[model samples]
Target: MASSIHSPNQQLAYQQARQHFHNQQNQKIQIFWSNQTQDIKQMNDFKNHSLPLARIKKIMKADEDVRMISAEAPIVFAKACEMFILELTLRSWIHTEENKHRTLQKNDIASAITRTDIFDFLVDIVPRDELKEDGLGIPRVAFQAGAGSSSDHLPYYYMLPHHPSPVGASGMFYTAPQPCPSLAYMHWPQLPQQEPPKTDT
Candidate 1:
């Protein structure tokens, strides 16, 4: 018996399917920067100690026109303010790199917030139209030609955006594609359980 060859249409379909698979794999890889631990630690310290306790309290007292603040209010506010600064800086840095700019600019911060939906509440405060006026709508620098090297410290991951929390309001986190190892085999009573059926002897 002779082995059969694929028909012309079948060959074409196979080639197209293979090409589609490669395209889908490529799409799954998104480029992003690796975290800088030194910068994170420095920012954490600044968040904790950069603001004076007295000043935070003083500002709270000044808002007595329509509000009252407890002693713990200043502490909370200071911490929140620090986190806000760090969040904005991180977001702006991402945009700067995305625009292929080495320097972080005010406009980059605006663009980041504008592009991200979580910052929609701040849209009224940031000038969205000014991006075009300032020529920032276009990436400041073009990607280097013939630079197929992945030496730019770029990394890729599969993740989904998490809801805003006090600590992770930035929503940047990695979620593993597979089931968690620790919980994969755990059984819970809340889940439906089946007991062995008994038949009359």
Candidate 2:
């Protein structure tokens, strides 16, 4: 009996099969925030009294999950932080206003943005290397100084994205698999149309 020899096509088929197997093995489930619409609603509720800006900031800063990921992935961490802060600020403003039951008035959003110091602080913090370091050994004093010393009249809140990815078909698209939560809001209108703000760190 003659021994069978593998042809080039057979070898190529084998390689393809192996590659597919490996690809399947490498696939993983990545959980992330899927929608900003929900965040807007949550912010409105937060404004109405479910959660406060200060408390939200404390949660974002102290949450082990957020802090652990934030050290190595500053941009993502920063964006998440920014989003959280914005939501908290908006919520706080809505709750304080005379019309608590009204729809999210445009001025309320603007006032929330203006009153919340976290946005500007984020503009500075997101760019710093200290916040990106392993262990995220950022000093408390540094945060306080940046937030407190700034002459700008912005009120401080800790709402912001710890991780922010772009939105597009190629980017993260809103879909059923990833339901949009009530606490997700993107500063899309506020963000420049060009590339995302660069990380200075």
Candidate 2 segments exceeding 4 Å error? 1-86, 89-97, 120-201
Off by over 4 Å in 1: 1-48, 65-68, 129-201
lDDT of 2 by residue, 1-201 (tens): 775696677767866765564344224101113345455445432223333445455545554435444333443344456767556554435433423455655444544444445444443333322323456764333222222225222445555455544555567753323333333664445755687878888
Provide the lDDT at 180 for model 2. 36
- Provide the lDDT at 130 for model 2: 30
Worst 10 residues of 1 by lDDT: 149-158
Residue-level lDDT of model 1, residues 104-139, one tens digit each, is 887777766665555665655665443233565763
Say which candidate scores most in TM-score.
Answer: 1
